[model samples]
Target: MILHLVSSPPQINLDLTDCVSNSESDATLQHNCLHVTGSIDKETDSRQFISYCMNEYSPKWNIQSNSRERKFTFVELYKHNITSRHLYLWSAPMDVAERYQFYLDQLSISNEASMATQLFYNCTPPRFGPICQYAFDDYRPDHLSLNEIIHDFYLHGYEPTTLTCYVHLQCDRGPAPACLDWSEICDGKVDCLDGGRDEEHCWQLEANECADDQYRCVNGQCIPYTFFRDNTAIPDCLDGSDEYFESKDKRANCKIAESVFECEDLTCTIGHRSWASPLTSSCAQSRSDLLIKAMFLHKPNSVLDECWSAFLCIIHGSNPSDTICGDFCVGQTFNHERKTVRSSYGIKIEF
Candidate 1:
């Protein structure tokens, strides 16, 4: 049987190759201590470390994984009954010893603390939560230098320091200085509050093709594009990107989000009889800031707020509310934006 005698200091490794022998009559069998050398292969090193913990730590280890698992975790390091997890990286037994020293230094245990270790790295988190994994082949002191081993560890998967959430996701920016949460990203909420910076680039157009009676939205959602071809119908795409002006008139039969008046500035897509008069931005963020501050001459007692005068004020650096703002609005006419009522979900997917 092959028995591996684990050395007291893990840094040293030995493999004892032996043969059975006996002394004969009038013959003295003299044997010398055989020196067996071994290399600290990472895969074998992990097994040896596991064996050491299982055999030495025993009950305190509380390991439930079978021999094949090769992974284990230790909890309850700092607080009592508090749920917490950690990911740590280490290079050597001295590194492990330093981590233990950190626990003591942080008052996890006092100087008079027992020689018992309370917790460790294990197979939890389904995947490694926050981790520093080294895929090094071997870390034998006699075979490789410290710098060389560390180089291998770095090449495998060692970070110089802790990575932030955004950095982990490789996002352009985080919600705040150094905070990043994977859950908050791409959830339709602007967690960063930086004008949807966190949500940017979370999705992209992959393909576009729709079956009959289905309209493909710019967002890749398939809906009814047109009920009847050759009809003056506005598109139902939420962004109105599907609607195209024919013959340069910039007018089309389009299904609009709301029945609203169009602005005198043909360039502005936002129309308002008033649901949007008081508001400057909408769900699509299509409202123009310049229009909101433009000189609006109130058409008092007019039918359906028939029109508002967005007269270009001549007064330099003055707002539409300026006393002289109306002097310039004499002939300006802002037309009421037109739109058909919103249509219902017109198409159904066929499984």
Candidate 2:
């Protein structure tokens, strides 16, 4: 509740504890009034001073000095709004008030318009926007002091500094600044428009094993773990290993989605390809022949479509398109820069 009045006006300093009445009924009401003089100062709009006080403390008392006479007058501040009863007034320490006056006067004369915008626009620190109109509810706390706020402005300008992710993500420098996410870096995709800086050091990814939350493609591209077996026609890996359903290379590495049910019985195996496995009668009882034909009959362009559609039918006796399959079957590569989470459901599937 410490207030730093920007305009120089000699104010009477009174402790809130002293303002409380001896009467038990009025003590709480008087105690609450101890902190509000500071509240009007916190608001950026100076015009709100009277209206805010009237709306806040409707049952008002006017203290005036008339030529050596001390007079107390009671007035109805807000004639229409009588229900609002809460109002309080508090004073700042002399030291804090003096410091605020000094800084306000100094900043008002600065060459840079932005330097004094906070004072001129009537907005407090950490409260930014046009005319200091917007601020987070938690931006100003009751305990914060004006000196500490001024120090903050000096240490890190009036506004918060925006950090650029390009440096952290190792993106190439371009005319327009570009930012990349950690997932997009070395994920078998080029995100930076300048020179594909995101994919520059991808050779390191091929050499190193992926993290627990990531999946390594055949070409050694590390993508989000959920990207594996995402049920999309378009591949997550550069080599299309994630979507290479039944491809020998896919099963050779033992990289498979948990959703996929691998048939254990060798008696029902029709194809020798590691990735190509059809649900056999031994695994289940229904549609064994039709599943085999769907897996082997057509050399579909996207292995994702054939296996997902057939597997869903075998497992649940339902088409994947109607239930679990993704909307994409267009074989188009996604722009990783614009889209952070490439998968429809961005959740990690743990084995």
Candidate 3:
């Protein structure tokens, strides 16, 4: 079970179109997974080993065998898109789990980075004999161990869920990385703790209804630029994120009123509010208190019992979503002149 992927890359030329014709049913390996062999216990180490084979090891295959062949690579497991767990999960022969146990043994040798180089060498388990033909093309060694290595790096202090948008989440919240799922964008609540990076340029993904001269950010607002970055002096997108790489010098020296603010356990500087717009109605009241504690785990922007300000709509029992900015919720309050408005029309409603 040793993988010698250093001096030379492993040969990944396997065409198992006939052998593994029906992945779920034809998996002779899967049937054998129940009859655990070797010192490896099925209950304890199987999960990680299975993840390694299905996620780390399989993606290396070149995948030209057939439609079913494409379905078996470990890459599918990386994205969490599939549910079937132990179909072809064996490392050696169907009756033996020694190779898988060896994989776990290597992991215990050291942290991901310092593991024994011998683990990188290629040694096909007996079950691989059938599917080895399915592995067409030279095996590109994951020298970085990107496949075998653990991925809990917490990329940029966010919870690292395949970061398609990296610059948008530059640690406005705290040390733990916040995962940026594209689905979360424009979904109503400001899930990203960064001022408004998650919501910027959201309208672009929707059907076209924008002006020719202006561009749109996710917030559904129109500005004087067409695309995200049009070489403009200032960022047309409200979240300064669009111009992040363009104007490094100006961003190095930003000026905010206080230049610093504190929210609960987190202390933030003006830099933390890079995308905040003080004059704009949408962001005018953006305060340090806006950064909620991630420990809540309810979702981003979950409200606390104490009100940050009466101006926020939550004080008036308006939380359209679990949490939203106060201004967006307040709209035009029924109260008049900061006082209760007495009306002759009385309507009673039941919850």
TM-score of each: 0.19, 0.19, 0.20
lDDT of each: 0.30, 0.34, 0.31
Q: Which stretches of candidate 2 lie over 4 Å from their true place?
A: 1-119, 124-130, 143-179, 182-197, 201-351
Best model number under lDDT: 2
User: What's model 3's lDDT at 93?
Assistant: 31
Candidate 1 regions with alpha-carbon error over 4 angstroms: 1-213, 225-233, 241-243, 246-286, 289-351
lDDT by residue for model 2 (144-249), tens: 5433332233334222122223345545422222234343455444556557776786787568798999988775668898868874433556445676443334
RMSD to the true structure for each prediction, in A, is: 28.2, 24.9, 21.8
Determine which window of 10 residues in candidate 1 has minimal summed lDDT: 342-351
Among residues 3 or more apart in sequence or in different chains, the pairs in candidate 2 whose N, CA or C atoms overlap within 3 Å are 33-88, 37-89, 37-90, 246-275, 246-276
Ranking by lDDT: 2, 3, 1
lDDT value, residue 48 of candidate 3: 28
